[model samples]
Target: MTDPLALRHEHAFDIRINFDKRWSTGPVYGGASIGYTSIGEGSTVEGPMLTGTLVDYSGADWPVVRADGVVELNAHYMIRAEDGALIYIRNLGYVHRPLRTKGQGPDEEPDVPAYFRCTPYFKAPEDGPHAWLNRTVIVGVGQRQPKVTAEDPPDHSLFRYYAIR
Candidate 1:
């Protein structure tokens, strides 16, 4: 007999959303508000089978921190494929994680309840090479780090996606 709980995933892509600055609207109903957007050489995407860069002047992410500590982020961006086909992706995720302590590794993930997870929806040309993106069920894991100044690497939110089969 096969185990029904067993699941599989295929590597899709990864990205680093470079942070430039941040501004927040103080506590309001349900939670606080955050608005994020970037332009000009936005970011890059690379992986086993995907290659693209976010379109210059077309990216935004709004992440809100609730009074209870969970963060809700909605990111919208356009990617220019190596073949020049344009793809739009909206990735929404949530987290209730604590900031990294003194010696945690950059790529480590906390236990459940502090987990950062996301679901990505894509819009690609129906007849294009990336049309697979449109129908596949993709899930992603995300992590946000801290950094400041142009000299230091900008703070970035990292994400990797996989298609469930």
Candidate 2:
């Protein structure tokens, strides 16, 4: 069996942020190629974002920081071949949680919800120009730690971001 966390190169779409909803979606043009290594099935990656920082670059600044606000992410990807093609492909297979900047990780493990229609973006094929294809979103958390030994640790914070398909 293949390791779920194995690294692979793939094409991804541009990422767009939905300011009002505080969510991001893939681009509509063509997919952007990206290099990713699997972190493992059902594993959480945590990080921190500057308090009250805006996530979207193009939109007005909206504060994401709060006494409670922390970025949390959980998702899984799938590898498959496009129809009638021999090449193996990996896409965001499921979105388990909303993107938010918060203080800590979720208390329980997340579950993969239903699949949604991903935005189609153009991606340059290996041998030709870019073409449109629906891209998936990958979600993971970020973590911050204090400089301390394993026995005595400081605070831990979690952040989240989505990679384009």
lDDT of 2 by residue, 62-156 (tens): 21221222212222222212222122222222222343334535763433332222221122234422122224333433333433786843333
Error of 2 at 67 (Å): 0.9
Kindly provide the TM-score of model 1 when superposed on the true structure, using C-alpha atoms.
0.81
- Give per-residue CA lDDT, model 1, range 1-165, as digits (tens): 877888978998898777655667777876676655453356788887678888876877777877757788787889888889999999898887655554667786634446799998999999968999988989999877667666877667788989887
Find the candidate with the highest lDDT and give its number: 1
Which regions of candidate 2 deviate over 4 angstroms?
A: 4-58, 68-133, 138-165
Q: Give candidate 1 regions above 4 Å deviation.
A: 1-5, 37-42, 99-113, 149-151
TM-score of each prediction: 0.81, 0.18
